[model samples]
Target: MIENLWLIGIGTGSPLHVTGEGMQALRDAAVILVPTKGAGKDDLAALRHAIVTASGTYAKVIAFEYPVRDPSLPYIERVTAWHDEIALRWQHALKDAIVGGPVALLVWGDPSLYDSTMRIAERLDPLPKIRIVPGITAIQALTAAHAIPLNTLGGPVQITTGRQLRAQGWPSRAETVVVMLDSECSFRTLDPEGLLIWWGAFLGMEEQVLFHGPLAEAADQIEAIRQTARAEHGWIMDTYLLRRT
Candidate 1:
């Protein structure tokens, strides 16, 4: 029976982003779960392995194939089913690895932030005690790469996904917004006038890319860069911050 489940955030694609606490958790874990999401994402899988190796963890690192969401199902239903399948895989992997006392899953960015790891963990029967080891987030990485503050002075900041931005447009009365998990370049859906954008891809990693300027001027360029990077790498994780100029 699993006694402890650790959702350790490793940050966006960088071993260096693993915190001292996160490293210690790796060392203490009995089994570490690494997930591979099939073709076009081998780099991500390798990076996870590299992180575990770099941490010098003696724990057993078990790699599992991640379940792909069914495209035919509606978005919410598809994601729900996918998470269920993943939880089952996690159980199988954990049991196969050992009589798990403490198992760690390296999360890409903090588990609390737009990640489904926590939800999947909940699906485990007799839910194990969950612990989260936080790491730097893509938002932090994006802002740091551009040397910009997250919010306008004393103003509220809105953080959302690309889907929401596309479906709902900008949040009302919000001066600043951060977008994550956006593959569609949703910024194009909005009128670029009076907007400034700071965008980054593969943040905190060697192939890191950044672009910033007036949205009207940078939208096309950013989209081009995104397409080129995605074509070359086969997969891309990007985020951007938009503010009213």
Candidate 2:
């Protein structure tokens, strides 16, 4: 029988975003593993703590410090190694856990969307049967936070990363593009003319900040706020949407 491993999406930065299904999974799991990205991201681990408290789960909770990639190496190679290391940590931790019963990992956002907990989990030896509990995604949170629809009437949407947008420029055949995991604010590299932007940081959290205006007019302001927020908190996760008028 394949061992049970559950990836529970706790939503991004919001305990309220945790679905009743996800909470029930947490309450039922034999073990819950929370990733610790070190100090600046302690709040992320805290978010999981909040979920546990809210769910009223008494499951064994373990905090593991995730492996950090060497920035000097190529992205693919470095991330590949990082994932391997993380899997090793999980293997060691789970091996001796509460009878190796159903294991739960509290992931940010939906596990299928950009978040990589599932990829690392795939590397575990004697892989566990993977089950996912979906939660709100950053794009969804951003759009709702801004009171805007994801796309214009009948318009296609392109979702991409900052690196791809920076390298390939704007994508064709899409009226709206949503960018995530971009620490650099790559939107400034595009021609801001005829474009509108809605940017948000710490979405669904108390410290959330938002800006919306003509791209050319608000790009700088958004970057400035992003920098200030990052410096203030020592970390930041943000997303933005771009639409051509």
Candidate 3:
């Protein structure tokens, strides 16, 4: 059984995005687990290694091949199975290191956000004492890069995924809706009238791209840019904020 598991948020791509506490956790970890998303995504794994190195940590780094979900399975079933497999992978990765000391996993954004790390951790046979070392979230990074506040004069802000936005349309009474994990550019399905969008990709990274304008005018351009960027770099993680203008 894993003794202690530290879910450290490494933020987007910058090592500086890791907070002082996260850095210290890295330094203190005996073994760090890094997930490799197969071919064409080596940069993602490399970045984690670089982050660990930057922390000046001599901890042993173990890389595991992340499992791909089955497309045939329904959404909930597929995700549940995927998480189970990931939990099994974590167990296998730490088979020899449980007694070493605290084990750490570098998460891409805050664990409490849309991440499933905590849920995956629970699938472990004997749950380890889990500790979260919070770091900069993508939302924070996005807003900072845009120099915009998340809420509009104390108005409520709703955060949802592209899937939910596409399925539920717009949430009523939401002055601001922040969309994440939207590969489809789901905003295209919206009316776009009186809507303003501030979008950012690879936020907090050197290769970040941003666009802001009326949704009606900027949706197509944003999608085109997203397509080109995804083709150039095997993957892309982006988020956008929509406000009623």
lDDT of each: 0.92, 0.89, 0.93
Winner by lDDT: 3
| CA error at residue 171 for candidate 1, angstroms | 0.5
Model 1 weakest lDDT span, ten residues long: 92-101
lDDT of 1 by residue, 1-245 (tens): 67799999999978989999999999999888899988989889898889888888899878888987899999999999999999999888766455546889999988889998999999999999999999889999899989999999999899999999999999998999999999899999999999999999999999999999999999999999999999998989999999998
Choose the strongest candidate by TM-score: 3
Q: Which prediction has more favorable TM-score, 1 or 3?
A: 3
Q: Over the stretch 102-211, how does candidate 3's per-residue lDDT look in tens digits? A: 98999998998999999999998788999999978899988999999999998999999999999999999999999998989999989999999999998887889999
- Least well predicted 10-residue stretch by lDDT in candidate 2: 92-101
Off by over 4 Å in 2: none
Off by over 4 Å in 1: none
lDDT, model 1: 0.92
